[model samples]
Target: MAQGIRVLHVLGNTQLGGAESRVMDLYRHMDRERVRFDFLVHTEKEGHFDKEIKELGGQIFCVPRFRLYNFFSYRKAVKNFFEGHREFQAVQGHITSTASIYLPIAKKAGIPVTIAHARSAGVDKGIKGKMTRWMRRNLSKKADYLFTCSELAGISVFGEKAVREGKTIFIPNAIDCRLFAYNEKKRMELRRKLGIEDKYVIGHVGRFHYAKNHEYLLHIFAELCKKEKLNEDLKNKKSFVLLLLGEGSGMEGARALAEELGIADRVYFLGNRDNIYDYYQAMDYFVYPSRYEGLPGTMVEAQASGLKCVMSDTICREVAVTELVHTMDIRADAALWADYIRETADYQRKSHVEEMQKAGFDVNGQAERMMAFYENGNFDA
Candidate 1:
């Protein structure tokens, strides 16, 4: 083993989602002296983080697009693995497909350490979810280490037979606090720029998807609007507005739903922007009504930004480190979620801000931990 370790991180895409964001965060802050990082992405299409990764001095390898079961893809990926094998001390695969496809090759390449990282509970309903679980159970054991973002996610894949007695390790997503620190000036500026004034902003940041449950969020917001209209106390004290960030396949559907609800005027769909943190500053409350998660990075970022969060209980428990966050059942009625939103919208929360900073969910600490893990090969088994 050498004094400095070289690690190759393999992911299915380079998009600015939770998994990709975390990978970039780690790369940006990891100890340069102790660990060197590079990437392998399956897509040839450029992603939002590509330029940033290159600027950080990490190499990017592009693999051809192929179905996970495609033999040609495996052959090409294996060849690529051999080409970079000598340069990397270890290889870490970030998603199920990547893990299933590359772990065997890395093992054969005689890499000192091969890690299979499970970043989500598995994809939502479809043949895709079934195939991902099958791969996790059948192929994940090839790696020297199995890592998951949360205990729930690990169990969902490995089941009681494999991980209940402690076979896999849990490392919740880490956040860079400095990046989301409370910027009073920036918050005001963003609010002015967005033309959001004299209103309470409820924010949700994620790609539109079934798992994210954006339909439920719209329903909840509509309920809140109606409640405010009827309740004198609520009507006089505060106004409600929704801020939706990110774009995806379900985006147009989501926009249509908002229009159907007749609250389209009150909702702002900012699409995708590079300065998401700025939007966080302008938000008054954060809502994450996800049906499932591997530990959401947005939850951490929202809490770090000092916004009181109302998330689905299932996902909120994974991020139970903060008191500023509240949760309800994923199947909770719209009325219940609406009540929660109205109650917390006007509440002042300075104590929660202090708590997040104390917890070290901040970026620098997370980077140090990752750097140490790469340098020493210690996974706390």
Candidate 2:
């Protein structure tokens, strides 16, 4: 018999995404001899973490994406998997859109724990978004545990009543704080390498999805360039630059919009990166005008790196682990957003490891809490 307590995590893929990153952080810190994780991702394409997961002694299973017209086939696939494989102590549904269908199947198949882990507060627009919200309507009732990373996410997916009645558990999308902690030497080195040593660097780290509001971010950059009085050194037309990190369908759209807005020269799409934490060191400020989020780990990463962040109010206020984070409505004008970033650009930067840990956003502490739950099915998160 295998000695490790095996837990299965469901996600879109092992890609460098918010939920995937958080789970990987937890997995990295676990007592692997006593507990291990296996993944059930929706894609057949290999993911960023696939090699590492295998090396760490974990399994990966794949299923085709679920569609309304193929509900029967999807349900059959899930049922067949759970009925045949009985190794999992728990099935964690990070992709909660289909949890209402899968968790009950896991429970019926004798899995001791079923978790609906809501990682985002909003969905895609139009038909896709409507379908997703419909699918998640009964997710809370289907799971033994309703796990959410933020208050807004909990209320949004699990329903306000379930959250209010104390049925929902708050799990900070914790991270390795030490990795992102500020270092002046590293900052200077990266700035010089990127040739932005003298320019004011505003940053963002996320895929160029509809929710990330890339177009609005560009508009903000254009506005920021117009505000010469904000800083003397950066008052030159070319002194302020925006560094966009991550790739997606919206990337070309963002680039085109940058050109249309006449700020193409100032915007650099760095694409997806392995050393993302370093960019935080090089940046003077961070802006995330997202339409919605669960609990963005980048906000924690930004705070850990001591970068002042101005994000949309749609993000849960709980991510404000420190006073470094400020919010604005999504409806607000780009000029107003620029003013906030420019006004706060004068603050000193420092390490926030202590603050991050104090707010329970550090991985080490939560790893213990999660390990205890998986080892003996004791629930505390």
Candidate 3:
């Protein structure tokens, strides 16, 4: 028999993405003696966090990727999984695209609580995006509780009334604020280690994807490098460094674009980093040009680490918990973003941990509330 209340988190994978990272932070912070988190991921291949999760005594279950044609088969897979392992006290569906299908099944299988969590404010482009939108159209009707990372995400997935009427629970993407607090020693050490002590390191943390807007990010970096070439005091393009942290199918494309722009040597692609917070300390500036997001946790981490961030206006405004982050339109010219970074890069870096904690983006407090959520239906109460 299980020793604690088991909460099943349905995700695409336990990879190092925004949602995955945020959840993993909460898992590490939560009191495991009272609450334990298990994963029901869509992919069979082991994820980056699999080993850590197992070490923490959480079970991992896999199911096939759900396509529209395999709808019934996917339902069967979820049903069979629940039938064999009915230990879950609550099922929190992070993948809202299929939450409509799975949450109801979990409820039918005698799970007392079903949570449909909306973690993304936008969808992918083209046919797949259409499929995602179609699948989650009625997700709000299926789950016992509706949770959203941001108001934009709630309105997008659960409709405007659900959000406006306060039917949805707003769960900010919380992090371990202390981990990301500014440390001058770590900054100097890592910068020296990377041979970028003299360089203005521009950092970005996210997988290369259409939503992440890596192409736009590269273009902005290229523009910034061009500015460096013209600046007599800034020396040369070598003085500017771009460190992209994350990996995906779009990595090669970003690399090729960097080469085409003649800044290949200036860009470093650090794939799936475990010490991502340390990298934030080493960074002088953080830049995120994503097309959309559900209150990106990276922004909070960057702010906590005392790095000034230039954000895309498309993301939810809820993430600007600190005054360090400034928003610009994704449709704006790359030079405009470059101009902003150049003008604002010199601000004194100081940890915004207090602001993050006050804004409720700190993970420790939320983890306790989450434990209560799984144990009882009135999570907020």
The C-alpha TM-scores of every prediction are 0.92, 0.96, 0.96
| lDDT digits (tens) for residues 148-179 of candidate 3 | 99999998789888888998999989999999
- Please, what are the lDDT tens digits per residue for candidate 2 over residues 34-105? 889999998899999999999888999988889899899999999999998888988999988899988999
Per-residue lDDT, model 1, residue 276, is 84
Model 2 pairs in collision: none
Supply the TM-score for candidate 1: 0.92
Which of candidates 1 and 2 is the stronger one according to TM-score? Answer: 2
Question: Which runs of model 1 end up more than 4 angstroms from their true locations?
Answer: 231-236, 351-354, 357-360, 379-381
By summed lDDT, which 10 consecutive residues of candidate 1 come out lowest? 348-357
**Which stretches in model 3 have alpha-carbon errors above 4 Å?**
1-3, 230-238
Candidate 1, 163-187: lDDT as tens digits: 7768787766776666687788888
Cα-based lDDT for every prediction: 0.77, 0.89, 0.89
Q: What is the lDDT of candidate 2?
A: 0.89
In order of listing, the candidates' clash counts read: 3, 0, 0
Stretches of candidate 2 off by over 4 Å are 1-3, 233-238, 379-381
